[model samples]
Target chain A: MACDARGKTTTIKILTGLLRPSEGQAYIWGVDVEKEPEHAMSRVGAVVETPELYPELTPLEILTYVGRLREMSPDAIRDRSKVVLDEVKMSEWADKRTGKFSKGMKQRVGIAQALLNQPDLLILDEPTGGLDPRGMAEVRDVIKGLGRSGITVFMSSHLLYEVQETCDSVALINKGKLLMYDDLARISLWRKGGRVEVEALPPIPPEIVERVQAAPGVKSVRGPDGNRIVVELEGGDEERAALLRQLLGWGLRVRSFKDVEMPLESLYLELVKESR
Target chain B: MATEGATQPTVPQAPQPTVPQADRRTARGARFLIVARFELMRQLRRRRLLILLIITAIFLVLLIVVIQVFRTASADSYSYASSFGGFVPTLAALAATFFGADALVGEFEHRTGYLLFPQPVTRTSIFLGKLVAGFSLTAVTLAVYYGVVATATAIVTRGLPIEIAYSFLLAVLYSTAALGVAFVLSSTLKGTTSASVMTFAVLFLMLAIVTAIFSVADLRPDGNLAFAGGTISNILSGPYPQAYPGDTEFPGGPGPGGRFRVYSPAVPLSILVMAIWAAVGFGLAWALYRRKEMKG
Candidate 1:
């Protein structure tokens, strides 16, 4: 599963081989998380909500410590940590204490730590939460790259645009309930409708507005600009053709025609409203 | 086009090997050690710990000098040494108790616990690692104090006896037990200040007030019926009473000065009480930590 900043994601860390779920079981590469959690979690890397770095330690030192927990050799830890830090573009600040790092730098350090072992499942929550636009792009690219490398990326964020741009598939959750789970394109398909900006040859007649609203498969009709009326159709090409014919039959001139794609923010708000 | 594509060499492939499961486990252990080392290093670098150690060391040195000067001035050196030795356990207990009371509680107050809980490692490992580090630091401080006392005593007396050495060792052990009690209390208390206050209050009540009541009851005419006083006496004498009066004289008293009195509770009972407290405290900390939600 992959999620961008826009989707709601929930992550639970059940310690390797120590805890069993109260309701269900989780598996890691066919190994039960509760029964063989160590084996299962060995292939998992996570960057929880906050950067878990020790504030007193430098970024390099923190990475080295986490590397040691994995029992990596001294040379391997040094090499891997160097590469990860460089990947996160934090090598310049590797020696600086984490307490002094900005929010974006801390987020990068968190990502670097999570990517250390290159686990099969990389779970990140609001990975770009505190980053500026450039930092957000950097993290988004890193996550996309991880997904390309065959890692399952599960992320959750309140930013709809980020999720739409980064995720291949999304599961929309609100108040702990699943709203929609599908490919982004499929969700975006729900936005299909013909939108036209109409300026009458002379001027629009009230009779034409009534006639268009009364046409088949016309969901709604509104005049956004004085000279333009946007008609939302319920069907695809067939509905659009029928509406155009009816409008022409009413002697209304169609100045221009266009299709509108719903923005993710609007779609999210619509889903949230529908659920409620 | 096909020939050109074929002629273009692919990126060099690095050799990868399948590590055995045992090897992977070893790797994880290494990672845990790195984490443990980082934890220790962080504590070592703390200004508070450094200041505490420095202040403790200076105070210990001055305390030894004063004790030695007073011991030499008093003609009854043996009685003074014995009395002083008896107070060592209580003093050590008081220090360790207060130190332990702030151990975990302070971390919570500072919101540092959240940073460690979400890792792949279990809470047990985190707790054990921190406890080991904290205990080691406390032990080192206590050892330094012991060394200072020993040196001062030898200088004052011109030689040291085997009994003093034994008593000092026992005192160290009692301090460890007291530290365990405080550690457990630290985990139980919600706030660092409250934990410290409660720990000191409990130590003072048990060592001083309880001992005083017991002494008063033992002097009562009818030994059979002082309920609160008798209970206090039993509590003091039943387990780990510090000083037990033997065949030595009571110094600076009207009666003969050869009577010996035991004050603190017995070592074995103190150990048991401390162990139970540690166990319960640790158990509660583990449960609460395991269930705690990590907020961003």
Candidate 2:
């Protein structure tokens, strides 16, 4: 989900049984969180908004502590700590104290502990909120890997790109209101229309641009941004292919013609603006 | 990175392990021990424990220096042990405030609760675990101090007073009461330093003020933990000090003040009062902790 400073964290907190809702009830895996928090929380492994670990302890010790809380056997904690630590790429630092760890390293450890219980559901809140580019990519990769492992991952972030890259479905919220909830593809292609970027040899004339614009199912043609022009086209794959063919027949040396990917940022902005 | 259209290698996922079903009592008991063990380790690693031990050593040395300076070599073993136990209440308060002042509050203040509170364990388990750990640390410190006094009494007076054991028991009771108060403050306060200062202040300054008021008003300060702690030393006196309530000639004569009022609760009553303080303090702390939220 993508939401700006709204109630995303609050909702996640309630779901994780951190806060008792003033009204309304929430459930996790058929168990009411407020009614049976221990049972509900047992199924969930969560990292809520920059979890801070005990600096005096090593990652191994911290994970062991969490494992014990989960009521796992000592042998299980040992074996599982190794696997989860490796999953987050924190095995090398497992025994090292977290006091002097970099933010990225600590974040990785946070993810590691959340995975220690082998929970059925994983919830992360802005896993890459504060990190360098490399750290963000690494964390995104870890999150994506977890998603592919079949554990249901529900993550909330304001970064559209991160959600776009890491999540299969998206839930957008604004002003504590859920604006939309659907698969990523559906939201990105909600209008049954998209922009197609065309790259051809330089010195292409304006007649071709006009012809492309006048083609059936084409909404508008914008910019020869360097060697590229973005054609706003309606309908699906067949119409886009037909337009590419017509452009080729117009005696234009079209090097490439591909549908421009609609960034989730645009959809998020539009949805948020419309909500307001 | 796997590119688009490339067949992604199937990574084996970790097995989803369900938490084993133990009887609720056994599970809570096991978790309590685990938390207490780790909590104890956390406290043991801190420099504050060492600081408290060093302070105890300094106080012991001071006791020896005073004994030599005052030339009280003829004092009996009971008097020597009583003098040693006299410092128990102050040391116990210091120990409780130092070890337990941030016991619960630190979880929120230092952001550790963000990780801890989401676990499957119940808040009751966490509270009891922390209380046991704090009590253990305080009790152990008191034990060590009393152990030294016992050894000194054995060496200097060539005899051990049986009352030393009772004195030690009262000292521990007093410390537990102090720790209970500290835990209450820790759970309710938002900052660790404030909780620690408030605990020390409440135990020493605030309670002392209440005891003094009770004394001046000619009411027995039996309910005051500060006044009740006097039983730790009073038990060692051959003839326990009798309550000279209302007005009487000063024990030290009218050298300074003319008349003085004294208040002393019996040993059994003092023990009961201290136990009540500890129990009520812990019960109140647990109640507050159960409802406390980690807003930050």
Candidate 3:
């Protein structure tokens, strides 16, 4: 999900049973959180905000501790610890004290601990919040990999690109209320039509640009600066294909043609604007 | 608007059957042990515990030196060893303060509760588990302190006093009581350092001040934890000291009436009071911790 610094963490905490909601109720797998929190939380793994691990403990020891609390057996904890450490790419640092670890390394360990139980749901709050570009990419890859592996990953992030790249679905939250909830494909499609960016080989004449604008299903056309023109069209893949064919027939050597995806930032701004 | 269930997604996994309610009760017992074992390990790995141990060793060495060099004539085993017991309350206070004072509050203060509090175990199990671990640490320290005193007394007097064992028991009770109070402060306070300092101040300083005031006014200070802990040494004085406040008149001594007042609680009463402090303290700590919510 994508959200600002409002109640994202509070919502995650309440879901994870860290904080009791002042009113209403929350259930996990049909078990009520306030009534039977332990049972409700049994299959849920979460990293709320920045998880503060004990500096004195190694990642292996910490995972073992968490595993024991989860009531996993000795053999299971040992086996799963190895699997999760390798999953987060922390196998080499498993025995080193977390005190000496970088923030990124500790974050990887945090992810590893959350994955230790093979949870059905993994909730991560701002998983890449304090990371450098490389660190952010590394953690984002881990999260993406987990999502592909079929764990329902519910992650809260303010980074639009990160959400665009990582999540299949996005829920935009503002002021403790969900403003928009939809799949990424729908959100990425512009309101009128899909935008297509076409590159032709060399300087195209104004006649060719006019020809492109006059084509069927074309909403508007912009650019041709540096051999590229961005066209807003009325349809999806078939329409884009027809435009590509039409460009070739016009005797303009088309270099590259693809859809220009709307950035998540624009969609977020639009939602926030609409909510206001 | 009551918030209802925050459900987890049910995905098919490797056949780990759901535990029944009866079995969950048993799992809670196992979880309590897990918490206690790891809590003990956390305390053991801390630098503060090592520092406390070093301080304990130094204190023991000094007691040995004073026993051998300063006194040419050895006193009875009970009197000699019970003098060492007078310092037990202080040692207990230090151990409890170091381990117990930040036990619960540190999770929130340092934000480690983000990792811990979401687990399947209930808050009651966590609180009791940590309580046991803190009490265990303090109890072990008291045991070591008494062991040294016992060995030294046996070497000089060639006889061990039964009162020394009773005194050790009283000290252990007092230490657990001190730890209970520390956990209460730990669960209530927002900062770990504040909890630690306030626990030490309340147990080692404030309670003593209250007891002293009550004694000055010729009132029974039996209910005060510090006064209750006084039995650790009072029992060692032999015949259990005076149970009530009274003035001892001296014809030539310098006093308001040439009289010195004495106040000591009966040994049984002190034991009962310390137990109550421990029980009440743990109960109150658990009640507060279980209801606490993470807002930060």
Best by DockQ: 2
Candidate 3, residues A1-276, lDDT tens digits: the string is 445666788788888878888777776666787778677777777888878888888999999988888777777778889998997889998898787788778778888878878887788999998889998888888888889887888888887778889989877767676666667787645333567888988988789899989999998999878899999887756678888899999898988987676556655555566567
Error (Å) of candidate 1 at residue A69 is 1.9
Scored by lDDT, model 1 comes in at 0.58
Please, what are the lDDT tens digits per residue for candidate 2 over residues A1-276? 555678788878877766778887777776777777777777678888777888888999998898878776677788889998888788898889888888788788888888886777898878897889999999999888888887778888888677778888877777666666767776645434668889999867888888887899999989877778998877666687798889889888899987566556655655666666
List the candidate numbers ranked by TM-score, top first: 2, 3, 1
Candidate 2, which segments miss by more than 4 Å at Cα? A189-263, B1-26, B68-74, B239-258
Instruction: List per-prediction Cα lDDT, in the order shown.
Output: 0.58, 0.80, 0.79
True contacts kept of each: 0.14, 0.40, 0.46
Q: Which stretches of candidate 1 lie over 4 Å from their true place?
A: A1-37, A189-208, A232-267, A273-276, B1-35, B73-115, B163-175, B178-263
lDDT, candidate 1, A1-276, per-residue tens? 223322243334333332334556656556666554445555566676555456778988877766655455667778778889999999999999888778788788888877777666777767887778899899999998888877778777777677887888776655544555667776645433445445657577777788878888887789645767888776756677777777787877777666554345545555556666
Looking at model 3, residue B194 earns an lDDT score of: 95
Q: Write the per-residue lDDT of candidate 3 for residues B1-296, one digit (tens) a residue.
A: 11122122343432343322112333656677788888888888886667887898898889888877776574776667766877888988898899899999988987888888878778888887898788888888888888888888899878787778888999999998998899899989999999999999998899989987876666778899998887788677653343322334335434466543456666788889999999999999999998888776
Provide the TM-score for each candidate, comma-separated: 0.75, 0.84, 0.83
Residue B95 C-alpha lDDT in model 3: 85
